[model samples]
Target: MKIVDVICTPGLTGFYFDDQRAIKKGAGHDGFTYTGDTVTEGFTQVRQKGESISVMFILEDGQVSHGDCAAVQYSGAGGRDPLFLAQDFIPVIEKEIAPKLIGREITSFKAMAEEFDKMTVNGNRLHTAIRYGISQAILDAVAKTQKLTMAEVIRNEYNPGAELLPVAVFAQSGDDRYDNVDKMIIKEADVLPHALINHVEDKLGAKGEKLLEYVKWLRDRIIKLRVREDYAPIFHIDVYGTIGAAFDVNIKAMADYIQTLAEAANPFHLRIEGPMDVEDRQKQMEAMRDLRAELDGRGLSVELVADEWCNTVQDVKFFTDNKAGHMVQIKTPDLGGVNNIADAIMYCKANGMGAYCGGTCNETNRSAEVTTNIGIACGAKQVLAKPGMGVDEGMMIVKNEMNRVLALAGRRK
Candidate 1:
């Protein structure tokens, strides 16, 4: 069946996700302050709820399938305002995207996404948040027509006969306060059985020594309280450019910080993210490649991950091909199009770079579920459990999808 009309429903609000499970540097997310060093800095997100849009496709046969839009709270091409994005995206959908999709056949999900990407190239710089909604809606329509799970469709189209495996899960868990940290350690170790990775990625402000000290405390606490004595989960940290900012292009200084963190996290490896930030994708790749080489040369086991500037497939590929970073996050919301995220993961796998499928905390349960399935289907290293404050919600959605897909695969076999 051909497409009929595409409709967007706005005013769906989502809670901003927690920042690395750690106490944020500035004003805390949702206005909850963990460290009360009152400086009207506002580095953390205060608004937990923001309006979003849900795009629905009404086929000529009157069948409907929908998709939710997830936008970052503080960062995006349009500057983190979902309401503004929803408002600005309406015309792009109606005037540009919808017309192109109106009479198009919906046989290939991959082809549709690629065609849409081409159509949106050049002057059509519509943000990925908008593209995410339309592409998801169309994919939902395709899945409905084919009678298969979202992950199944990807397997059939991209890697036929590829085996489906359970996606290894990671939960955000870093609270500056001892009590919060205590709670997270217990939950991550005891409560969540498959959480092989305990993550903490956030803005740490500008104190290098203080950052180093705190991470030491964190590593010790987690190792001490961990459930499996033999199994030490990966300690992943995303600083969001604070490390590079503190050193100010001093590679030696950055090396000192990395070495300090490496020493503290010794025996248990560390995955550090956003060690530097550059606006230009090329410059960002250069910085990442430099750091990666530095770490390798210094015999540091720290794995560098690129997040900020590598928001699209081509950018991610550049980072991979150049060996700029050990791994790159597919960054689901920023990249949109579930198929693109899947393709990016495959690209990383083929290129020998690590792949992690991730999304903003600004997503919903529905969007989170979609991401979970896509990441699991594509066999990503890990999928960021999202669309909520605590990890349980994202974890629950991800686990449920795994069970569902497992059942589907069993039936098909």
Candidate 2:
């Protein structure tokens, strides 16, 4: 199908605020200074905000598909504004990206995405929001044309012989470093502190030493409540790199911090993300290598996940190729489009590294649905439920989509 027209609309997904008192090194932003007990980087408790741009992909066949831009809010750990960045999508997609796509054969999402990357502003890559909007619109239009699930289209287009396995649903509980808990609470929360079905307030709310104590509580609670009687829940925590930050980026101190969590999550290995975020990619990789070595040297089963600065597919591959981190996240928006994202996940698989397909609560059901398929088609370790604050809502959207895709695939077989 050829692209016919592209339209954009900008609006607030929800209100969001950040105090930047992230427990660990502040996953997205590194320079966290303390004002008494709290971090001083934009410290405030006003209501947080989330904004998104709606994209309509019009094809020559009169078929219209939808997409959304606006990755997770906290991606600013790289020092960028998501909402402000989202505003650029309207002009960029309408003026720059749309021109290249109109009347072009979009049978290959991968091909068109490459062209979109070439639509840079003054040698700078398009802002993630712009890329995300353009990428999703293309993918949505392609999927609509194929009469298949998004995951099915992804599997057919990329990752030949790829298994559509059940992507593990990672429940994001409690608070985020950049999220304001007091103001961002969901009125329909079945699980308090988390919109999903887990209670991790003690684990996430505690600071410093209390982190250890609360983690133990979190472990026991997960085992008792979340896991089956015969099964142990794998304890996965995104540390926000505060452990490394608190330890002054000392490898031993950071490893020691992880060891404590490892011990707390005994019998089940702990998967930890954002141990540290350094000034540059080299320093970040160096920190990753050092921390991984320390964890290995101590015989800790803690898996060090690289999230900070591993923003793009190249970044993820760099981490995987160097063995810098045990797991590298294929952050969907960072990879620009899902087609590029699938290849990155395949890269992780080919290299024997763990791949986590993740997104932020700052997305919509449409975006979450698309990534859920990408995660399954690429055989990722897990996919984060997102597009909204409630964990249950994110989980519901992604999990339901996975179920639908698999069922349809079965019938096709």
Scored by lDDT, the top model is 1
Give the winner by TM-score: 2
| Candidate 2 lDDT over residue span 4-79, tens digit each | 8877787665324343435243334334322223342443322246667888878888988877776565544465
C-alpha RMSD values across all candidates: 5.6, 6.2
Q: Write the residue-wise lDDT of candidate 1 on 82-139 in tens digits.
A: 3334566676677777777777777888888766645654575556676666667767
What TM-score would each prediction reach against the true structure?
0.80, 0.81
Clashes of each: 2, 16
The residue-level lDDT of candidate 1 at 60 comes to 74
In model 2, where do residues sit more than 4 Å from their true spots? 14-48, 75-88, 121-124, 176-208
Q: What lDDT does model 2 reach?
A: 0.67
TM-score of decoy 2: 0.81
| Local error of candidate 2 at residue 405 (angstroms) | 1.2
